[model samples]
Target: MRILALTSWWPEPANNGSRLRIANLLRALAQKHEVHLVSFRQEAVSAQQIQRMLRICASVDVVPQRVWRPQPGEQIVSLWRSEPASVRATWNPEFAARVGERATDARPDVVVAFQIDTAPYALHVARAPRLLEELEVGNIHAHYVNQTSTHRRLRAWLTWRKHASYVQRLLRHFDACTVVSDNEQQLVRRIAPEMEAIHVLPNGADVHGCARDWGSPEPDTLIYPGALTYDANFDAVKYFISEIFPRVRHVRPGVRFVVTGAAPPELRVALPQAEGVHFTGYVDDVRSLIARSWCEVVPLRQGGGTRLKVLEALALGTPVVSTPKGVEGLDLKQDEHVLIAQTPGEFAAATVRLLEEPELRSRLASAGRQIVAQKYDWSSIGQRLVDLVAALAPHTVVQSKRHLPGQISV
Candidate 1:
């Protein structure tokens, strides 16, 4: 079957969780089906990165998007008029047009949109069984709204309201939807209760790629790998550095905390200047970093969905200390597959315990690896996705109406 997968970003050499998930999904899907990927490339990506993404997918097309920032005058006007700075005009009409043209020619059996932003393009395609993969609900924006100051909170609230409406509207148009975790699926059901088909397809890792020797002793380091620009990751790192790291240092001054990922300029500036904290902007081999770490810490407080970092850490047989939110989607047992901690104090305590008790760490690591092998491996998860697409296809029929100009039709 020919499948057109739409995503906001395509994985390349970059260490991005979303890109990695999408790439793994596409690669697995490509094994049985002819998969074509269309992704939106932001300015940070290069030509080499595009080529790398192409190599992973059967065919790849990218729509270049420029990050638009409001002018100083526009910002002032927004403040007075009570509008958001995030407002930007879509400039890639040709990309949408090309997708529609491709849909007509390729006549794919299925269309899958990876995120809410790409849903609009997929919705325009009227001739295929459409699946919207909602990795996370917009609940993070609500969290941000609570975290922001009064002035910012009002703007965030307004922006979130608009976005929520847009998502609900799009949800009705798709034949089926899939989310990374049960938590996100529940949230979707609450908002769009009428939607019959909502599947919980948890995030998965490349277990084969992550397999390594667990017998070798690792360095006394804790690693946190994720995109720093994301609020959840930024908050996790900030909480660790400000509240948890200090306590951990007092207990074990020799242990190092490594923060590894692509950081925005603002997050980069806020890095702790302490002796034990090492802020590596981006690294090519995140697995090597995980392999060398004593334990992986996932202190995410404000995000919905299953974290790939947790899966990757577990896949590498690295003991993980994370919040309940961090391990929400997976079937993990506390003190076995992973250590679940909520507060900063509990998180620090768990980290220290894992670092000190080698036997406990070993037990947790073994259990975690077993969990990944059983459930979160890419091959297993991908087969489930393939089955869903096949099941939905027989009931799906192509509509004759052409989508509006600049719209994507699946």
Candidate 2:
């Protein structure tokens, strides 16, 4: 079977969660079928990266992403021509034409759009079953920004409404859709109730890389690893510094917090200066930090979908204390796989308790690792994606019956 996977960018060296998801999904598809990747290349892709794709993919076509801001007349014409928000005009117009040309020659059996921005190109391929993978409900994040913004609140609110409308319009076109969690699936349905076949394809981690026995932890060390430049993560770090970490330090004076991930100067300045707070600008691997930590903290106030950070921590057998919003969409129970806290004081208390009580930390770490190994490994999640695609394009190829060692059969 020939599958055309469309993405907004080349998903190689998938250091981030979103790119990791697409890379793993394509790896799964490539195992059983011919996968031709046609994606936008925002920057010059490294030769090593293209070679990585060449190893797994049948062929790859990279469409150069260029800047295109329309003038007043062009903006009017764009609004008249498409239901998508005007911001989408920035997408290379030649993308759809390129996809059309490929479809004419390669004749793909199915088209899978990895993100909402690339759905228009996938939908343009009329004969194939179009599958849209919604990483998260974009409007939900837009709403979060709206609720949190001060000076730009009105602009954020308007953007949220526009994205909501765009989602409703796009939802009606796809044959099937998948989101990162049940919570996001419900959000999509609420926004567009008439649509069916919207499924929950939860986020996962590379358990094999993370499923290991953590060595002796550094006493009183807490780690928070994520894309710190993202609004929610930046806010989470700031919230911890402002409201949560001080409370923890008061209880445990030696407690030190490590904020690790990519960050901009603005995000860095947003974090309050404190004696115990340390920031690692970017990390190639967070497992070392997680392994050496007394516990991992996720004090997220606003974010949608399940957190890969939580999954990665759990897979590493690192005890985790997170806010209810932090672990949203994951099937985790308080005191079982993780310790959930809603308020800053509660979060701080959870952190201090995990630090002081060795037995509690051990129990949570063991349970969390067991949960991810059993349910959230990449192989199992990849197979789930395959199952959905198979159902949509059953005539294309027979679904593989094989599963990874720890993977549950799809």
Candidate 3:
């Protein structure tokens, strides 16, 4: 089976959650079938990264990424459009032309759009069964309920209504769709109650890669493996540094907090000041830091899909202490697979408890690792995606012979 995949993210620098998911899923699809990746080049993907991708993908094609920045009048004008303003804004004629041409020449059996961001392009792929992979709409809905001010709530509600209607309308273009968790699956059902075949496919980690010893755990240390560039992650760390960490510091003065990822200078400078807060800017492989930490902290207040940080931490045999919202859409059980805390006080207590109780850490670590290996490992989870997409075209024979570079465009 020949497959064409569209992505909003450049799967290189698989450092972030989005890239890693897209890269691994493509690899999985390419294992038994030829996969042609038509991805938006969100950044400068190195020659090394390009070569790595070609090893799995038959050919990799990239279109320049154009972010849709809503203009002043766009919101008011969107009220008159059939689709959301962002949807109209996202349509790139060059990307559409290229995708149509490629799909026509390659004659793929299935077309996969990685996220809703890529759906506009995927829609241009003529006469192929489409699969909407990792479609997430829950986080938008979360904003409506979580907003504090009435104005913010009303704004979020309006945004939610727009996106909800857009999502429902978008479902008409695909044969099937997948989301990260049962929670998201439920959200999709509620939004589009008549929509069927929504698969719950959570984000995965490289379990075997993390299972390797990266050295002993660092004493009195906690890690949050996410970049401060993302709002949720930035909010999480700020929430921790301002509210939760101080509480934990009162009990355990020596405890350290480590955050890994690139930080914008302004955002970095604006971060709340605190002792023992270290940010390792953009690690290519964060597994060592994760494995070396006493535990991983995820105080995420908002995000789409499941978090790979929690999954990767579990894979690294590190116990996780997360807010209920942090672990939303994951298979983790509170206190068993991970420790769940809702508020600043409870979160600080959970962090301190994990630090003090070595036996509890070991227990959660063992349980977490086991669960990740069984359910959240990329090898298994990736294959599940492959099987799901393959099911779309059951009768097609998978083309096993590798295509020579001379035989097709690379």
TM-score on alpha carbons, each prediction: 0.86, 0.88, 0.96
* Model 2, span 1-410: residue lDDT tens: 67778887679657677777888899889887667778887578876677668677666777777656556565345445445444465656677777887677668878899977788778778788889986467435546464655746765654555567778888788888999877688778888888889888888989887756557779999999877868888889889999999999998999899988887887677678887988887787678888889799998877676788899888888899999888888999999999999888888889999999999988998999899988899999898888788888877656432332221000
lDDT of 1 by residue, 302-365 (tens): 7766788899999988899998878877899999789999888999999999999989988988
**Per-residue lDDT tens digits of candidate 3, residues 142-202?**
8788899998998788888989988998898889999989988999999888789899888
**TM-score of predicted structure 2:** 0.88
How big is the positional error of residue 266 in model 2, measured in Å on the Cα after superposition? 4.0
Q: Number of the top candidate by lDDT?
A: 3
> Between the candidate structures 2 and 3, which one is better when assessed by TM-score?
3
lDDT of 3: 0.86
Superposition error at 149 for model 1 (Å): 7.5
**lDDT of candidate model 1 versus the reference:** 0.76
| Candidate 3 ranges beyond 4 A from true positions | 406-410
The Cα error of candidate 1 at residue 163, in Å, is 2.1
What residue pairs are clashing in model 1?
Answer: 124-408, 124-409, 125-408, 125-409, 125-410
Model 2: C-alpha RMSD to truth?
Answer: 5.3
Order of all candidates by lDDT, from best down to worst? 3, 2, 1
Question: Among these predicted structures, which one has the highest TM-score?
Answer: 3
Clashes of each: 5, 0, 1
